[model samples]
Target: MSDRRAIPPHSPPSPCVNICVMHKTRDLCVGCFRSLDEIASWGSMAPAAQREIIDQLPARRQSLKRR
Candidate 1:
């Protein structure tokens, strides 16, 4: 039997829900709640930066709900 351990994901999964529309006034993706710059930079961003953005998603979604 081989001793194997599950490997963790290399990077944070994207926030894209494939609903790729941008909010006109808010300047955030209505689905993922990320700004255009954030979206564009996602692939190049470090894991920590990615996590920071992910951490903000809930609050961003909540704020959108208030609109």
Candidate 2:
């Protein structure tokens, strides 16, 4: 039998639900709550970095609600 263990996937599935609308003043996609920069960089970011952004998403959304 082969010795190699199955590796977990590196990228977390995207949060995008195809809503795609960027809130004009906040500059974040309303569906995924990612800033334009975050959205642009997501494809290239390391998995750990991507997780950090994901962790921040809820707070970002909350801030939007307060505005």
Candidate 3:
């Protein structure tokens, strides 16, 4: 199942940083990782808006995950 929801004309942007830090337990970044606020905000973002943020995630996440 997905966490799809309603979106408005404007949506929040990506929360990322060039400096990444992967958490040992979560296998996610300690730095530049999405906060609870961002996740909550996602469902209200447009598809195109979500895509824009998502596109940068994989590379950034992968870079951290690799370390």
Give each model's whole-structure lDDT.
Answer: 0.92, 0.89, 0.62
Candidate 2: what lDDT? 0.89
Write the candidate numbers in order of decreasing lDDT.
1, 2, 3
Q: Give the top-scoring candidate (lDDT).
A: 1
Model 1 global lDDT (CA atoms, 0 to 1): 0.92
State every prediction's TM-score relative to the real structure.
0.83, 0.79, 0.41
Which residue window of length 10 is worst by lDDT in model 1? Answer: 6-15
Q: Write the per-residue lDDT of candidate 1 for residues 1-67, one digit (tens) a residue.
A: 9999987557799999999998888999999999999999999898889999999999999988899
Clashes of each: 0, 0, 0
Summarize candidate 2's per-residue lDDT along 1-67 as a digit string, tens digits.
8899988669998778898999999899999999888888889988888899899989988988898
Q: How many times do residue backbones clash in model 1? A: 0
Model 1, C-alpha of 24: deviation from truth (Å):
1.4
Q: Which lDDT tens digits does candidate 3 get at residues 1-67?
A: 9998875555445565654655665555566654445456778777676777677666766766676
Which of candidates 1 and 3 reaches a greater lDDT? 1
Error of 2 at 4 (Å): 7.6
TM-score ranking, high to low: 1, 2, 3
